[model samples]
Target: MSLASHLDELSRKHSDIERQINAAMLHPSIDALEIANLKRRKLALKDEIEKLKSQPTSH
Candidate 1:
């Protein structure tokens, strides 16, 4: 996939995870570990997106 599309997909996933985290927070029954995992995944995606964005595009 092209970098732009890949970034878009990652961003979409990050947003979804954010929503999941917020929804999970609303429920007291949600496991803390699960939330932590979700947060970690979100951070990973964000880091990847940033790393990709920082690279110089090749012609």
Candidate 2:
């Protein structure tokens, strides 16, 4: 996939995970570990997006 498309997919995933985290926060029964795992995954996605954005894709 092109860099732009890859970034878009990562961003979409990040947003989805963000929504999931928010929704999980609203439920009293949600496990803290699950929420933490989601947060870690979200962070990883963000890092990947940032890394992709920073590099010169054409190089």
Candidate 3:
């Protein structure tokens, strides 16, 4: 796949993960550990997206 395609896929996945984390956080029965893990995963995805955005596009 091309770089743009890869970035699009990553962005979609990041959005899905963000939604999941938000849902989990809103659940009253969610365990603290689970919430923490979800948050960590969200942060990692955000970092990856930022790294991809910072990369120079190939002509």
lDDT of each: 0.99, 0.94, 0.82
Looking at model 2, the pairs that clash are none
Which residue pairs in candidate 1 have backbone atoms (N, alpha carbon, C) closer than 3 angstroms, thus clashing?
A: none
Error of 3 at 28 (Å): 1.6
Q: Arrange candidates by TM-score, highest first: which order? A: 1, 2, 3
Cand. 3 Cα-lDDT: 0.82
The residue-by-residue lDDT of candidate 3 on 1-59, one tens digit each, is 88778878878887887788789888889898987887787788778878988998777
Better of 2 and 3 by TM-score: 2
TM-score of 3: 0.78
Runs of candidate 1 with Cα error greater than 4 angstroms are: none
RMSD (CA, Å), each prediction: 0.4, 1.0, 1.4
- Per-model TM-score, in order, reads 0.98, 0.94, 0.78
For model 3, how big is the CA root-mean-square deviation? 1.4
